[model samples]
Target: MIWADFSDFVSHSRQHFEEGLIRAGYEEVDGGWSGQVEHIAGRTEIIISLPPRFPFVPPKATPANVADVPWSWHRERNGALCLVADDDHDGLWWREAPAFLEHIAAWFESCHGDWKDDRPDLDLDRYFHAANDDRLYIYGDLEAYRGEFVRFGTAPNNAMVMKGRGTRPAKVSKHLRDQFGYVADLGTVDVPPRNWKDLLAHIDASGYLERKIRERLIGLLVLIYQRGDHEGTTFLKVTPTSNGGIDVRRLRSGADTPAARSARSGKDSVELGTRGIAVIGVGAVGSFVADMLIRAGVGRLTLIDDDVVMPGNLIRHLVGPEAVGRPKAEAVKDQLGRQYRLRDDQVEAMSQNALTSDVVFQVIQNHDLVINATADFAVTAFLHAAAQAAGKHVLSAALQNHGDTIRIDVLPPLAGARPLPASASPENHQEPTYYEAGCGSPISPTPPHTVIETAAVTVRHAIGLLLDEPVHPSGEIRQLKHTRNQ
Candidate 1:
């Protein structure tokens, strides 16, 4: 039988008057809650009544049973839910109405078959008297209705705030505005007006005008405008039980105004870093290529690889022992992330191998320059085919085993160059590959190591190539061939 609290039933009173049933005290039945209803199908009946908190709270219910069952309904044992007594301050009274009706309905059916006189109130016809005695009112017509709540943006005052880089957490709001002499418009949050004249006028012409604060203010204003209205006034109000993200109650759905659009476009472009470069593979040589590009002021560096640093690589890799186990891309990014002059976002890390032409093509298509540092033949072949097809400039480098010599090549679009046959001698190849043999071996862990020393030279050359600067001592290829019969 369902038993809804009196106070709760009235608050949730909907237009429909659904049925309710009282319970049979917390008793364990063989078939569960569903099966208990079958047991009392013939002997018991119920009458649902609405309390003051009608629709918003559970409804009130009383059951009448004749098949000799002595029992009273009780709440479920687990943790208390919305419809349970613990959820209500008035002791299961002012909860919700519909929930009450549901409980009563289940209890009425439970007492029919498991008839026992030892149970309390075995009177099948007397249950309806409780509803009549309390004079519980019936809400809307006994009809069913279903609806749901929809929220836009964040709800209430809940907001997600990201601290700007180098921004200290001191009185952020006041300090930012006071120092920068800018105001964070908490209004509609659309687009901030360009006229900082008013805020500037309000600034104390003395101690408040520091360069650092002024710089932060300008940066913050630009950032806010870039985020546009969505991140503005939208706040979420959520309790622990809420679903999805924070709820947003206020919505601004109108199209962007011309001024807002222009401001947003300008702000957005400046914030997007560089979107036209891909770095495939961040291995030994690849890292050098990326470093050269970054130092030469390349637009951005998008790195891709699926390998992690291992202990054995401590000898030759640019990264140190601290970065031993990190993904190469991430390690590269971590190193670059600390470089204040560099655009951190520009150095992305794709934790996957550049295995196919398609994979190379997808990344190359979006970038103006493709730097293949992976030093893998499969990856190199894919890069050549894809970058050549897409007309993207490709730079690839490799080194012979240990420290024989280094090879760096610039592959522009195929253009008018002679194409080699599917099968051709190494000498007949149009593009030259530097095959350095026994130039120098790396000195073990000491300062005058060959790998450490030569790497510096090769990286400088790469930088010159990227920046179109003059190469020192001419950028000609050198081959260290072995002489026989001396």
Candidate 2:
């Protein structure tokens, strides 16, 4: 139901919206409004339509002759201009119709002027329809195959490709061939093809469109092309059209190589990607801390947890109900892998108990740092010993006082540094009022907010340790008190 204030705002703004459009030289059409904007080349026609959820959702403006639009970077395949980035929320463009129209006019002028003032963005994929169901995995160094063919394999939902030395297909194992088809690269193009016609023309001009190759291109074709400073891959699905022509659709693709993923991870990724971290728990705080580190571009992570996800843990845990029975470490690893397109080497899951695992000491030695989030004194002591032996740093976070307090302790790698004493339980710490059905232990009443906030703080210290930044005054105890109005 619409709120009274919202209804009133809409009711009052409807007349002003229409008047603003008229003032901007727009005439009421069948469904919306139509207007013309003068550009350097000539006049360009534009159509504006108010969405059903007006004011909240911005009005959409599409070019009359979308195909004739010079630039394809900032417009959708259907000709709707992308005036704002997905993260842009500063301006409430929908509230003022005239300002919105002016924004569109500015966009057209920028496009007509070759978008000189706009930042360079390799957005050629916006020109074609996206194939949501299918995904292409790009592996190896694509730049090495600048003007050569590579080997690729295709399956129903997934496709894999790797760079080749030259035009010859590299020696691929039969097992890989069975999993991913090992075929010669379809072709290579210097520039991204805007449409199937342009793709075909490029192939023909390069003399790569032989009769045999043309037949092979009827189903699936992989093209390596230059996208700005780097080379990128595009997977095209070809189907015979009713008019005896071929339709090429671009499939969704992701980089499966470390370099590609690192490039997308931002500037600090290079440094973070080389550092390895080991998280000794996959509980609520541990799970989010690991996830945040991965998102911050940490290249390698080892998740150690023997606990399985339970329904009762959903309130504060990262995994969902689907992972209720799965090992927390494995579940978190799977989720992070899929979300970040991480390879197996990038994330390792150890489902063994960290306290008794034979490899715990080795894990501590292998990683640059170790994190203890188990909130159990025994586990903390075990990790502290292992970290001390390996001369590695350890950061530990826990909620105390029935979830009303947050405590974080940082142990440096220095020889004489010692772990801080655990805080004493508050006098008012009462027994849990609720318990899971099967478990005898009472559930800790920590809210989700406290869990996440603790995790954020933990990750900040963890990153500082990884980067060799000083995070002195190492021990912190914060009480989260509720404020009430007098």
Candidate 3:
């Protein structure tokens, strides 16, 4: 019996397998490739299995055990068989595969005509071009499909076959072996990943696992278990450990884990906690950046803003009437604490101006990134100079009124080299400036049309910057229309 299966993606593994078989003078007989199937041809039988991911990630494939097969022929003792040219990133297997096969037949003929025992070394140029051509096969490239993958395959006649094993089988084909990138050969039966506990929990709880939906569900579960439990929300600290170990303790939190009650209920302390963000403002724009930095998973946050919330700011500021008269830093801290479920120690609040000699500057030195979200031009200039001299990345967002219209600007770090200090050439430096009022109204009688169009654009601009995606400013904005004026 012969078995063959395609990966869940057009990865390097499938490319390696198909290219290997094709180079061996074997032609796919059927409709491309199939998964987890067996075909019997006389006394010979072969089985195939694919791992969860392919290409950027590899799948696990092992041979089935037979009653009487030579062990040496079945499994190599020394020199492991890794997927085709896994060491080289510029190979066909590393690239997408759908279109790569178009010229593969010609490539196979050219290479095999000379009978080279070893596979030919590929030039980086030819490999990248072939790999890039697979884009024609991808449906669409968008954020919705980030970290997503798909798979398809075919078994050719007189070339390869598919077979199913009853638990264990012997003598796996090199084709399957190379496709999965196995060092030697997968063991008798493909061992379900240890993370299968969460995978099974998902399927059993959900009651249905369509082949299409299973991969996505598993990926989601992995993400939840990774971000929610095992690793805290800090981006830099959220790295996976070696040994494929899952920090189960990190994954299970709150009601999900029974041990939540056993953990300390007081302030949660992080190591080297003194070094963290010190936000100088907590206005609408500033609050949004704080949220972005937090969601970007900054480990620690220290807020310093002296302004007290007023009733008018309730419309735009994240705080409200109940927070009126309260210091902005404390208000933001209290609000974010609710959203992120921050422990007492993860956040600290202070009320003050961010002047040069101010304690806030001392706190700012500890942070990795400083954001100047203040509307005051003087404050912005000081922050720009101070942060630049300290070699820190500064991000700021602002809105300018164009008479019934608002244009949002997101100033990222300067390109190429860091900006020189204002002290170096005081004459050459200009103060940071913007012409927007605290009330967020245009300086003149603005047209309602421009107001409607620009307001929508400003919100979208702000969000795109927060999401760290590219955004075009050609009068683009998020729209808000009245539906019969409720």
TM-scores of all models? Answer: 0.35, 0.66, 0.35
Candidate whose lDDT is highest: 2
Candidate 3 Cα misplacement greater than 4 A, ranges: 1-275, 388-393, 402-486
Candidate 3, TM-score vs. the true structure? 0.35
Find the 10 residues in a row with the least total lDDT in model 3: 178-187
Q: Candidate 3's residue-wise lDDT over 93-133, tens digit each?
A: 43433333323333234333432343332111111112111
Please give the distance, in angstroms, between residue 96's alpha carbon in candidate 3 and its true position after superposition: 21
Candidate 3 residue 313 C-alpha distance from true site, Å: 2.1
Query: How many clashes in each candidate?
Result: 74, 1, 45
* Candidate 2, superposed: residue stretches over 4 Å from native: 1-15, 38-45, 51-53, 62-71, 78-80, 130-194, 206-217, 259-267, 276-296, 299-370, 374-394, 411-429, 433-453, 468-472, 480-486
C-alpha lDDT values of all predictions: 0.43, 0.71, 0.40
Prediction 2 global C-alpha lDDT: 0.71
In candidate 2, position 26 carries an lDDT of: 90
Looking at candidate 1, what is the lDDT of residue 238? 15
Candidate 2 lDDT, 1-486, residue by residue in tens = 569988888766666777888988899887678998776677788888877777666778887767667545677666688886656556556567767867877887887676665554555566667654355655565555544444555545566555443232246445644222112232433334567677667554554443324444324455655434545566655555667566666666566676665566557777988999999888999999989889889989999999999888888988889999999999999989988888889999999888874677788778888888889899887777766667766888888877877888876534455545657776555567897778988888878998999998887778777777735446567777755365
